[model samples]
Target: MIRSPRGVEDILPSQVSQYQWIEKEASSLFSLYGYEEVRTPIFERAELFLRSLGEETDAGKQMYIFQDKKGRRLALRPEATAPVVRAYLQHNLYGKTREWRVYYLGSMFRYERPQAGRYREFRQIGIEAIGEGSPYLDVEIIEMAHQFFKRVGLDKVELQLNSIGCRKCRPFYEEKLKEYLKKNMDRLCPTCQRRYQYNVLRVLDCKNENCQLVIREAPWIGEYLCEDCSSHFQSVKEGLKALGIKFQINPHLVRGLDYYTRTIFEIISPVLGAQNAICSGGRYDDLIEELGGPSVPAMGFAMGVERVLLALREEKKGIPYKRLPLIYIATLGREGWRAGYELANLLRLKEIRVQLNTSKRKLSSQLSFAAKRGIRWVMILGEEEVKKRRVILRDMNSGTQKELEWEKLEENIEEIKS
Candidate 1:
């Protein structure tokens, strides 16, 4: 027998309802905020990620990179933000406008050790606000995430936010951080020493226990924010407060991506163990120009669907699970089949969910199958009922049966809808 590849999954029909619930809730919320949907290729030029997500992060370090027949380096997207920004530039999405709002739901690929809620292939729902760089836009996106979690019943998740200072102040802070690390280089881990030269900001996220200890006292970048960047960070906080959104400022929340500038955030849930962040995003004011497009500012966030399912399961909030079919048409013999098919077609034309049995099983067996699939009503179409131009509709829930002529089925569906 053949086996499926590692790190990928098949979402079965039984679980699709939960998936739909999350997507619908998120889609409705994003639409309410005026963010339209956008989609991009699952793969792109490898350089897109190498240049945008940062050359030093884990995604860049561990992505699934391969050469196509044309010998162009291509990679399955490890994250969505870069590609969205790539599209924004490629299509001139910003054009003369100062801003645009976009959202997407799709799967992302990464080659990593699969453990707990993390996977080699995962689903992500993300949003990007590009063009304008107001701190208010930053606050708006963050609030959207907060409210998304709140509405999804994961209200316990905490919002950890920080400002990673832009190009102007980041370099100065990096120098200071390197100097601080230099004094304790021996005490620092090898990775920290390597990061000290190129991207020391990432050294703070190191998982090595001793490395964390060495950098525990290291200077935080927030303290050294230049005046303009500092003011922007302050306004972001005030805006969050104005919207009644509470947050904890963490000086070390430098996200793994390099393009991110100024504000960064993570909506973390403690119930999920080390894999805590359910949703996260930040600002990248220079990413547009960096992609060789017009200079524009953007902010966005991504939520992992698989990780969220884990948290939702832990919270024990009941997602409605029902087999609420609109109508079920049961057929017995040749003549009944024709009538059942006609009735099924009519109900479907009226936009009703209708199921017809094609099996040769006994009436008992067909009824059992309908009940198992949660078919709410069963319209028995035996020869006798077909001859009368009527069908016996039985409410599987109440076991109540009534004879409804063909014309009355549409009305019955309306009553069900009501």
Candidate 2:
């Protein structure tokens, strides 16, 4: 038998209810923030990720790259923000509104070692607010994310916040950080040593124990932020405080993206050990212009649906599944099967959840199958019932039965279930 590729999971029927619940709750919550949904392709030109995520980032390194028949390079999207920005420019959405608010839910592909909440193929629910630069908007987005976690039944989630500084002062901070790293070069990890030459700030995000030790005393970006960035950061904190959204300022909290600027944050849950971040994003004030669009400030975040589900499981939270069929039609001969099929469609037209048994099984076997599946109501259609133009509806829960005329079945559907 052929097997699925490693690190990808099949969302089987037994487990799909949880994902459905998450999607529904996400749509509802996003709508409350005036964020309409947008969808982009699953793949795009490889240059998009390389340019947006940067050459040294893990997404650019781990993306699934391939060539089409025409030899054009393309990659399965490893994240959604770049694609969303591309769509915004391609459609000239910025022309309509000063701030375009949109959300997306889809699968993202990456090549990585599979672990507890991480997968090679994963799902992300994200929202983007483009064309706005106000610190109030920043606080609003953070509060919206917090509200989403609450609606999803998550608790003990820490909002780790930071300001990576913008281009104005980041150059100075980089020089200082490079100097620090150089003085402690021997204590740095080999990866940090290599990254120091290309992306020095990444060393602060390094997970290596020794590199972390070296990073502890490194100059903080907050100290070097220009006057504009400093004021904006302070205003964002004040706004968060006004809204009662608790956050911790982590100087080392540089998110894993090249586009982020000014403000960055990660929502970490203790339920996911080691890989604790369930959602992360930040302000990318220059990304829109970098992508060839007009200068537009944008900020958005993506939540790992798999990690959220894992957190929910660890919390033992109960997510209600979609309602099951209220009635099942079990037919006995060819004539009964024909009548049952017709009745099933009629009931369905009236918005009733009915399951029609299509098997050529005996009446007793059909009823047994329905019972085993926990179906509450079973409508029996046999030769006698077909001739009489009526159905015998049995209540599985109460072991009660009632006969109803064909013409009255639609009108009595509610009463029959009760």
In model 2, pairs of residues that clash are none
| Candidate 1: residue 105 Cα off by (Å) | 1.4
Best model per lDDT:
2
lDDT of 2 at 260: 94
Task: Report the error of model 2 at residue 144, Å.
Answer: 1.2
The C-alpha TM-scores of every prediction are: 0.93, 0.93
How well is each residue in 1-418 modelled by candidate 1, as lDDT tens digits? 9877887878887677778888999999999999999999999999999998777877888788999998999999999988998887777767746577899999899988889888888999999999878898998899999989988899789999999998899999989988888888887788777887777888888878888887689898888999989999999999999999999998778888888899999999989989988999999999988888888888999999988888998888787544356677889998898888988887778777788888877888989888998878888999899898998988888999999888777677777655
Whole-model lDDT, candidate 2? 0.91
Each model's RMSD to truth, in Å? 2.2, 2.2
